[model samples]
Target chain A: MQVHIPLKKVVDNSYDITIDTLPKMNFDTKVAVVTNQTVSKLHLDYLLSKISAKELHVITLQDGEEYKNQVSIDAILESLFENRFNRKSMLIAFGGGVIGDMTGYAASIFQRGIDFIQIPTTLLSQVDASVGGKTGMNNKYGKNLVGAFHQPKAVYIDPYFLTTLPQREFSAGVAEIVKMAVTFNKEFFTFLESADLNNPKVLQEVIKQAVQTKASVVAEDEKEKGIRAALNYGHTFGHVIENETQYKKFLHGEAVAIGMVMANEMAVKMNLMSEKEALRVKSLLEKYNLPVSYVIEDVRKFYETFFLDKKSSDSAITFVLPLGIGDFVITDKIDNGTIMCVLNKFGKN
Target chain B: MQVHIPLKKVVDNSYDITIDTLPKMNFDTKVAVVTNQTVSKLHLDYLLSKISAKELHVITLQDGEEYKNQVSIDAILESLFENRFNRKSMLIAFGGGVIGDMTGYAASIFQRGIDFIQIPTTLLSQVDASVGGKTGMNNKYGKNLVGAFHQPKAVYIDPYFLTTLPQREFSAGVAEIVKMAVTFNKEFFTFLESADLNNPKVLQEVIKQAVQTKASVVAEDEKEKGIRAALNYGHTFGHVIENETQYKKFLHGEAVAIGMVMANEMAVKMNLMSEKEALRVKSLLEKYNLPVSYVIEDVRKFYETFFLDKKSSDSAITFVLPLGIGDFVITDKIDNGTIMCVLNKFGKN
Candidate 1:
């Protein structure tokens, strides 16, 4: 017998994102803001001045993608438990995607689940990670292989934190903006190609567009069972690169920028996408100073790493290949020979 | 500003539950059938004969309610990690309520989460533990103060396993049956009051009714947000008794048997239940040879322990009092003086 259970009852986990500034959110529960040292140094006082919680605790970890692991998740959870946080307690993920994912994961498992709010300090997180309920710590196995789809009660995105962000990181965030544009919105891609991101107005619009595209997709397939996987456009290749480089060579967005180029090569080889459109994407990425090139030492070795990705299953290796500039196809039927040809071109280039 | 995202998803965890006799369920994943030495000695080979897994493992723990603690949960998880059981694995709980709760808790947190199947050998588990997804290990803080609402993929209730169950344990299961009947089903209570439990037909009907009732309730409220809390009819006082005894003296259901009497006493004093009806309930419990009395050493100390229960919140203790023979009311408004009066009566009696 099957019962149709409706998902309603107004789950009251809501947070606001201000592209221009951060807002003070008051709470009675014990509060822990998990952040990185860089973000802490820049905005901790600004954040502290704005909020009135019962007790405010800050846990700052080293800033980098390498630190987004189980140890980090453990540290955050241990701190919460040590502080005697109850069910009503909240965690504020107050940094970039690394801090956001690790903090979100800690919230998911600490006492089997609790409320957390995202105070994304980076543009990449504001546009990408903050809106998605994906929470996890990376393991040696693969990126996001160990994660729970835990939605934050609210996400507060303040572009005020963006003032102190380095240019490279800003470029990285633009890479994600480009990813959102390429995967779902052709008009947005065209708009971005012509827009000057240096202007605050255009950057805010960019964040809004990226979040809207993500929010719409997340609403349709929150758990990545279908069209949501399209969001992993540059990620399949990016994850392999990150693993190969030990997550130190490039920023996550930069690696994804290169990955988009690699996937475009595959699309070009398969005649699924025009070379002209691929070049257009590359040119746009280069305009943002996003890395559009990476050297793959071994084609076969690189190929083997894709299977390890949690996204790839036993029967086939799923590829999210761009169709033209804004549309994409998730196909696993592409033969290895075609894939090898695309990999070889990257080597020769 | 806000986006509605569906964070919960039906995980790709589907398993068949064959209820006839017992089928051999062995797989390639590292298997750990967490059973006690007593059950292991009697039914270990019977279980092994059925389970033909790639790496069949057995970690028999000591038998008894006292053994269900954080130490056991850690040992189970440690064993799984030591055996290198990855995220895609299974843990079979092969004993009573203690084994079921501990195994389920271990699976819920092992590497953040894993799959667990319930093979309830005790009547209490088959009727109570298996239906609700409540899984946890007892800590020094209190019973189930540390737990998660982790549903098992499936439950296999093979009555053949219950044949080896001790008479005391058997009566303990009856206590849960009475609690279920009184709280939710008036007709079930009426049937139970006259039902010949020794007869196979009667026992099967009672088990089916209790399981179906519990399953339907869980399906509606997966996370104890509403009607699910009603299931804890006799658990409030029972938890205090178990804690006082260090979970050693009485079987879990036996403790509940005495707890039901205490709750009925409070109900009679509060005018929620008639004294004559309360006596009828006590007589039914006595018919099963279940304990229906306990000495309250210190009313103040016993009252303090109620606050430690996960269900109780600040300044109020929610009590599930039997309104009559087959009805219960969940309330926190039963004043302190009235509660103290009931405790005093128990001491004097």
Candidate 2:
């Protein structure tokens, strides 16, 4: 009556996030370095110098969160197809989260999948996006509405590239660092509050810490089934904000910064965290000049957008709220009145 | 120097293929039954009557391999977003390989993958597509060029639906069955030579054998890195045929049928298979009235198209040829002359 399609094989998909200087690597197969014009303009030659492949090509895409869509994915895919890049071929995602996400996504779906490496240039990506296997592109529906969990072959997190990063983009990266600390490690949160990231050593340590927190979480729950949802401490509200603002008004990390503040307000109202602890987190975000507030024109419209987020189920919205600091609770039990109250506090644009 | 993204976790993606009368299934989550117009007209009511869900939706796509493209994928994704389907939701691929593939693909990308069930109505899907986790759609380049190996949660192979399957479609399924027999099982090949498939019991047994053979191979390789390539015995040439004709000339299995003949020619030329063995295989194909020969207007063009296949590396095309009735050898060593000679045998379209 039944035949079993047994997939009982164990796969060691474990890879390391090596925080070192960029190494000159030689590859035996065709390789494409998928980057954006912005990153390529500053670092393309430097990146190109270090990588040698049997056949090497560069694919430059438009930069920014808005460009993270199906069109960009098609561009990366089209290049691979045109070159007759097969499963043995590889892609090197060589930019910020936008380029990394789209490139990783294109790698995931191309010929069912091929090896890809991450040479994350932005501070945000070097810490968060580069390590996790979450590859996706944003669609009109929302951020990461379409993606796959295809791990990269390796990730190189070199701090040297961050030297050319814009201050605003650098601050955007700090927001993600702050996120990791608040949800997973109180010591790291305290360290981040006082740490001067302008110092290269401090920045490297911070990148290592944030990546470690994300790595452990991803290792435990790769699919965000349980403990991994904790990583979305600020993402629930952040995704809706990104949608309402059309993904142009704020960087992804900036949106999450505001989402964390919003979640803190809800946490305070629900007695999950003291107002004092909430202020501490908010002040830390302000330290980096990460956007901590976004006024919603219509509170109801902002609240309704949460339903479109992949994190929400049909019946209720799943919110990840901090349990003071260094821990969190993933709950869908928050009442509508409580959420509306929190959203209203952001005021109007 | 390093932070580990330790994904040393084992995932058991095993599922059973049930071959019986269609069974009533109930789900607690929102469900979408993705099928085509033809299947809907013949079997929608019965399928709907047997399926109950908290929120049920039917997405009927155009029936054909040509419709298996990004446009169709977008349609499926749009429906999920419009209906507010989430990770907790499930999809039931309730038609043939086309429906199963697009549905599985849609599910794989929806919120970075979700659970999908396969209820394959066509024999080609029941014994092949429904069991393997391989999910994708065709593009202008080739068949299944873009896809993910996202396994289904389960498969229901209800033979009752096959009674209404057109004679040609039935033979298309036979092509795949004959494929499994020739590549892996000498006894199975002998069974097909004399087996009365019109007998329901005989057909069910054959389906079970094919499923079993496929199940073991998938269990060993999972991602087609080794023995699984043997399953593509006819697919390399078949994909080019489908691409050349724009997926309109033959059913997928039918193309594979002709592809098998082409591979047999190469095998006989290389002394891997006896001419007598090749003739016996061709005769079995004729018994089912499966298409065995295809004329290429330009053999050079057809030969060049093999490079476009996913199985080919940049340098050489991999071919799976039968060493005899039940054994296979995967090689990329055949020179240009031998392949052209075989294509010359097929002649112009």
The number of the candidate with the highest DockQ is 2
lDDT of 2 by residue, A1-349 (tens): 9987778767889997899999888999999999988988999999899988999999999888988999989888889999999999999999999888888889999999999999999999999988878999888888899999989989999999999998988988888888889889999999988898888899889888899899989998888889989888889988888888888888888999999999999999999989999999999999888888788899888888899888898778998989989988889999998988888888684
Model 2 chain A poorest 10 in a row by lDDT: A3-12
| Model 1 spans > 4 angstroms off | A1-20, A24-37, A53-85, A109-112, A295-304, A337-349, B1-119, B136-154, B240-251, B274-305, B334-349
**Model 1, A232: alpha-carbon shift in Å?**
1.5
TM-score of chain A of 1: 0.95
Q: Write the per-residue lDDT of candidate 1 for residues A1-349, one digit (tens) a residue.
A: 2222222244433334455566668998778988899998988998889889988899989998888876787677667655666566789999999899888877775655778988898889999998878887676766765556678887777777788899999889888889888889999999988999778877787888888888888877765779988988888899999998998889999999999998888888888799899998999999988988888888888888887676765446788998888899999898989878877877735
Write down the worst ten-residue block by lDDT for model 1 chain B: B10-19
**RMSD (Å) of each candidate, 1 decimal:** 4.9, 1.1
Q: Write the per-residue lDDT of candidate 1 for residues B1-349, one digit (tens) a residue.
A: 4434444444333233334467667677667889998889988889888887768778889987777876787678667655656556789998888899888877876655678888888889988887677887676666765566677877887878878888899899999999888888888988899999778667767888888777767767777767777888889999998998888888889999999999988888888889898888899999989999888888889998887676775467889988786677889898999989888876734
What are the candidates' interface root-mean-square deviations? 6.0, 0.9
Report chain B TM per candidate: 0.94, 0.99
**Maximum-lDDT candidate:** 2
